[model samples]
Target: MNQSVFQKAMNEIHSRRLHASAENERRFQEINTVIPELAEINFQMAQTASRILHGEKIDKIRQQNLQAQRYARQLLVTHGYPEDYLDMHYTCPYCQDTGYFQGRYCTCLEKEIASLSVETLNRNTQLQLRSFDQFSLEYYRGLTKSNTKGETVDCYAKMKKTLDYCIQYARNFTAHAPSLLLYGEVGVGKTHLSLSIVTEVLRQGYEVIYDSVGNLTSQIEQEHFNREKSDINTLKLLLDAELLVMDDLGTEFQTSFTDSVIYNLINTRLNRNLPTIISTNLTPGKLEEQYDERIMSRLCAVYQVWELMGEDIRMLKMKERRSSQYL
Candidate 1:
């Protein structure tokens, strides 16, 4: 949103120049028949000035009237006129604000518009994405004291390490990076960490598409079988997004069609070298039991599974919120 504002302001410069030229042409037209010589001189002076601005080194008789007009603008304050009146009329002294130099677009205007287009595309995405700074370490539950000299860790310490890994992964993510599997208990910061990665990747100018397995299952089904033979929009998003986030992967409604679609989506992206991040509460044993060994093995081969071990952070937050309310 903030980026869009900057681009829009820059585009306005071209619009102002166009408006100034149109107004000047109209004024010259009105006086052409009544004062032919004066009108001709003024039009010719504007033409020559425009040429000079456009990089043409032409020698033409100086129009004293044009210089007099400039002097009037420069000394507007001394003559009791508004200080900004001349500047308000600042048609680019370079291109007469026409934005073309030598029959080509000005460098300054082209650069601004190119930047604006990037910001405009970036604006298509939601900007206030969840980030690492806002992530809560409190989400990882209690841990017993760690022994000195390379001791075994507790659930809290293990999950804390996972959080740090997630932060680092997001910070340095590339298209070639390995896919991530976040298999864990419910409400143990799985979704939170995934969103944090989404936010961070967005800051790096990567397009990310977020969808839960359940939502995606229904969407693909409707697009493929229920309504249309082909859905171009769905295909474009899945193919073009820099990162594809599939949350709660194993909980979608089971069907032969859903199963095949899910498999194909993952398989397609993997073959194309696009990375996918999948989060699920199902254990590895359960994944094999629920989805066939074929699907599970394909996923395991393609992704580095991170099994999260922590109590429900949602319950803890609810308890804290209740306690604070009583106080």
Candidate 2:
């Protein structure tokens, strides 16, 4: 949980409380102007505490308060308004929009924190535009690829299976879900499918972080050297997020610091059994060449590796657009 995120959630909860209070006040003023008898009943109800302080009998005051409330309701209904219209309507009734209950944070507040944390992490991502439904198999039609087992297979069939698997993975995602490594040439829909999974997992209310490897590494490095003047612990959030999607894995500016940070990130998340999705243009050989053996070993042994097979979808789309313009 990031401190700034927590503070933002608290601020939102405070605003909600203020809004509810303001609305309640507004309704009271309206009803007071419309029905003066209800206003008198309200004043009498408000005097319960003062009467108790003045050594009045507690039971008598409690009875009087109940009678006043009933009379107020009757008056409201007789005046053609809902009996409970003047009641404070909190967004979350359990906490009265206060964000806490019984000395602990409420579930509604926790949900807000999780939602805001995801939003903060994905602030720069176009997460809303991608989905499994938007992924097309037409690009891979009439294509074929030889699998590692050396069998000729239809690329369209292969991609269809890959898409279905990704959909199921997203639908069934949990914190303990297995990590994934999606590898293929550039523009083969790796980022598309990864973002699709991210969209579904987020809809399921999990905190997900998605970004390019280069961008994430750069931020981590900047924060490490105290060059980025922000309180957010980017590395910690990446490690602690429910799901992390790292795109374009081999494109980062390599440095001793970045290499160490990347290794630590991969290693720590694996050790904690947290799920991660990594998309890269690098193959197994190139990945091993770029990262050290430890990182390679974890990815090879633990991650569910998927090779996306197709010609560049973006290039195909561009050619199709060009052909369409001529017609």
Candidate 3:
């Protein structure tokens, strides 16, 4: 993980602590309105403790402190308040918002760092601009049937179904949700829909790891092989994320390492029943040919496959812009 990202996480933890402390003080002030002597007793105890810390072992100081606490408790109970109500309310009591427990990083801090680090790494993508509501269905209107080669493949209906399924999938995503295999040609909104799911799943507070197959493989190779210089836990984050979305599956460099890594990752996710979303340009035949029968069988048997077909929406948008310019 990046050092700066870790620093941000630390800052967040400290900020929480500061806020809790301030709120606790405010609560105490509010309580003082009802029990003025309780606040005075607390102030006296603070002064006594300060003097004790400074080596002034005054006789009966400890007894006086205990008596003050007992009186405060009795008053609180009589007023229908919990004895310990004045204590700071921390979100994570394990670390008390300090991000560490017994000199070790707390689980809350680790999870926060992982989330921040992953988002930092994925910030290069244009995912923020792509959302289900923003995806225009107008482009798929004219070419309802037949693909680019004039094949009679009812492209429009398939595209519409794909869009609906993706939107629904995002709305009801769970850890055990069915894995998705989205295959089609370029610019058919596969990436857009996948990213839309990412946004929704994230909004629902689930961890999602979305990366192109090319970048995923490249990062794995760099970190796994070059262990000495690598600090990012790339593979761990991918495998542990609630949902993994690999866009443009077959665009990655073809190598023995890449093939094995992909197979292992997919197979592991399947074994664990973890949901994954894979979008590729390769047809079923091509996918089988490229990754062999094992991967194909797993995908076909376990994944909810969708084949989206439409003209390249990117080109359509470009043409529309040019036409508007001429107008």
lDDT of 2 by residue, 1-327 (tens): 447888998899999999999999999999999999999889888888888899999999888888888888999999999999999889999998888999999988877776776677678665554899899988997656554445677888888999999999999999999999998898989989999998899889788899988988998887778754654667877888889999998899988788888888888999999999999998888898898888899889999999898899999999999999999
**TM-score between model 3 and native:** 0.83
Q: What is the TM-score of each candidate against the true structure?
A: 0.58, 0.71, 0.83
Q: Candidate 1, residue 240: CA error in Å?
A: 4.0
TM-score preference between candidates 1 and 3, better one: 3
Comparison by TM-score, 2 against 3, better one: 3
lDDT of 1 at 29: 65
In angstroms, give how far residue 67 of model 2 lies from its true place.
16
Q: What order do you get sorting by lDDT, best first? A: 2, 3, 1
Q: How many residue pairs collide in each prediction?
A: 1, 0, 0
Q: Judged by lDDT against the true structure, how good is candidate 3?
A: 0.84
- Score each candidate by Cα lDDT: 0.69, 0.87, 0.84
User: Model 1 off-target regions past 4 Å?
Assistant: 1-128, 143-153, 226-231, 325-327
Candidate 3 Cα deviation (angstroms), residue 41: 2.8
